[model samples]
Target: MNENVSFYRDTWAEINLDAIEYNVKSMVEHLGGEGTVIAVVKANAYGHGDYEVACAALEAGADMLAVAFVDEAISLREKGMKVPILVLGASRPEDVQVSIDYDITLTAISLEWVKKAEQFAKEGVLQFHIKLDTGMGRLGITEKEELDELIQFAADSSSLSVRGIFTHFAAADELESDYTDCQFAAFKKLLGGISNKEWLIHCANSAAGLRFKDRIFNTVRLGIAMYGLSPSKEMNKELPYSLQEALSLHTKIVHVKKLPKGGKVSYGATYTAQEDEWIGTLPVGYADGWLRQLKESEVIAGGKRVQIIGRICMDQCMIRLPEKMPEGTKVTLIGRQAEEYIPIDEIADRLETINYEIPCILSARVPRMFLRNKSIMEVRNPIIQSHSASKG
Candidate 1:
């Protein structure tokens, strides 16, 4: 299945494309004909593999794809993604031509950005979605006067085409946020000036989409929830339906050794065997996104959970095996093995971070093996590709 590049490492992330499709379909069903779903495949689909996840989302009836910036949109375009790709972040006014050339939609956060972009819009239609800063305080028009000027300018420009207007909630993850209520009220007041009611209006991210159906106007941006992750731990209880997690981290035990009683393991000699114990070396470490902070974490081996012992090295770590497991035995850093399972949330807990940050932090050196219909669909090995490109 992995014929293109011979993988030289034992550790890789397995991405289930079916799970991605399932999550999208679940969201579509949850919306129940309420609005269009905008699949947020930014940060390489939260590091699940962008192109692969985008294709899966589209296949599951996502109306459009959203990315954080223009380069991300361009990457999807380069991969032949034909569906509408919206750049949710601010872009340089000079980059207007590139968006037009690639058929990517740009976000107009302010009149200043719009006027600067107008200079670059010598020719070709440039589509835009006006962003309103209701409560996020990140970008967009905060006042009615700014909104009116931006709308009027776009309506007057020969090259500019304003397709939509939207805002973001600062605390949609919290079900009881008075701030979210005020933000929606502000967004509605701003919407009063715009005559075009058909413009794609959206104000809901994953959390809002799942909890507040009234706020999701015509479109919902599915980001964290699209990857089968809850928008926040607190919102997990309110999920209308269950989501299928798609990624699993795996590696193989490369070396096994018997540690004498009181013998130490790894660089700092932090882990000592109270009794004679079997230790297995895994070819995964901090350099591969397996941070040293996870040295105390447990991994699934031989159908049981085993502790990762010692200070995690740059390229390797040691685990205390229950017995003398043979070299090349399977080890699951994340996912199910027999009855034992290690969710990404557990890894996140150990690192004192969110589950969304886990996969995004996985280094490029780790290959992503995409699975579809329970078979290997494709393998993306950046290391091998770089090597091949250098030789060429």
Candidate 2:
């Protein structure tokens, strides 16, 4: 069976659409089939390939797609994603109109930004969410006077329409309402005075959509939980439904060699052979989202788990495969079968980080394959706009 594997091949990131569709449908149960939901596909769908995952989410009934910037929106538009896309993050002041020109809605917080958008408008109205900050202390306006001023400005400006008013929860996924309730109360207080405008008053993200009963919102922008990842560790025990992971990563052994006892391996000689044993080099490493900190973890190979040894290099990592395993053995960096699974959660746990970083860190050099109905559908080439690679 090892003959089928090519040692020279590059590692791959695999996406399962069936599971993605299942996750979206399960998450959208509360949004109802009619209510709008904006799926955040900014980081190439968290490195799952935006176009591929966007289709799955839309197929599962997502009302719109959301991203962080104009460049990302253009990528989706270039790739034929015709669904309405809203830039949830702030649009560059210089490119505000560029976003409007491409039919991409922006999240404008000030009258100046709204006016900047007027330069590109010739006909149909340009839309954007008025972001309000309650607790996350991020890019949002918390001052009621300023928010009211913006609202008043929008009322007079026919070119701009207040599509939505939203705020981020400080601790919704923590399952604690102390701060969440405060944020909600503040959002409600702000919304109470605003009248007849048909703006989508939304604050609930994935956690609120799943746990909270009174969502009190027209639309929910789901990000992490849509990919079947719990927003935080606290929600793990409280989740009433099982969530299926949508991403799976796999690679094959590139080299298998037996070393003498006390032989040191890899760069820096950190891992010394305790006994005469077999070692297999995997072609997946930090470059493939397998961070160097995960050197303490293990990789599944030959139906058994193998510990990663020594320092992880840019394009390769070494795992202590069984002495009996033949060369070219299939290595599973992340999978879901055979009494084992290396889903993103596991990697996150090993690294003591969030699930978002796992997929986001996978280098663009790794080709992502999209699978639908348990069959190979298509391959999305390396992302060209990898400018956000260093972030998070």
Candidate 3:
């Protein structure tokens, strides 16, 4: 089903557009008529083909799209996406005009940034959201006096339009909701008399949006959950709705060899065969975002779990096979195989990280093959595209 089947390498990531659409629709319906969903497509939709995911999200009722920087928003624009995009990070003063030119929304982190951006505003109105650092203490206005000043300045500037004001929840995904409650209280106190109707006021990421639905907010930035990942493992039990995982990492065994007892495999000579064993070399490694730390992890082969032995290399890794599997055997790093499964959460648990980091770290070296209805809809191979373009 892959149109570029002959071009890309054996290792690739399969993205399910249907699953993405389902997740988005579930989030919207779960909101229960309170707020709109802003599909957070930053980090290339958390490294799952941004444009494709964005299109699927919009089709599923997402009200807007949000990215981390200006260039990311521009990329969506270049792909003919006209949805309102809010850049979540601070925009450089000099590049404010570029955001304005693209009709993108910028985040006003501080009164100083607002003042600086006002000076750069040349012609049309620039829309932005005021970020409040209620408790996160990462970005946004932290002081009440500063918030007042910024509100006044934005009101006075004819070239600037304040479309929304938002804060981030620090512990919304934890079992304890006390901290989230305090953060919401602080956000309300900071708002004072600023009517929510006047501007879009949001404070919920995926976790808070689901756990604290009673909180009054007009917009919810759907990030991890939109891609069918729980914000935290502990909170999985409390989820109100089911989420379908949309990503799967797969590769074919390119080489297979039988090693006798006392044989060592890969770098460091770390893995020594206890007895005669069949070893398969996978065409995926740290370079492809399969971190070396996953050397002890497991992959599915022959519909069974196989131990990954030896240190993962820059471009390859080895998996101990159940038997002498034939070459081109399908290996699943993060997906289902017959009766066995390797979830992203399992990989995250092994790596001592969160589920969000798992997919986001998958390098572009592994091309993305998007599927719908169990058939390849499109293939994005940067290596092949670059080579073809150069030749042209």
Off by over 4 Å in 3: 1-3, 196-198, 389-392
Q: Deviation in angstroms for 154 in model 3?
A: 1.8
Per-residue lDDT of model 2, residues 1-392, tens digit only: 22332223656767888888888888678655645677889998888889889999999988899998889999899888888888888776667556666788788766666666666565667788888888888878878888888888877877777788888887888765578888898888877777755777778888887777576477778788877788888898988577888888888777778888999887899989999988888887776677889886977887778899999998888887677576667777877647777777888889888888888888777777778887778775545335345453
Q: Which lDDT tens digits does candidate 3 get at residues 17-98?
A: 9999999999889987778899999999999999999999999999999999999999999989998999999889778888
Q: What order do candidates take by TM-score, descending?
A: 1, 3, 2
Q: Which residue runs of candidate 2 sit more than 4 Å off their true CA positions?
A: 1-10, 119-124, 383-392
Measured with C-alpha atoms, the lDDT of residue 126 in candidate 2 is 77
RMSD of each: 1.3, 4.1, 1.4
The local distance difference test score of model 2 is 0.79
C-alpha local distance difference test of each model? 0.91, 0.79, 0.91
> What's model 3's overall lDDT?
0.91
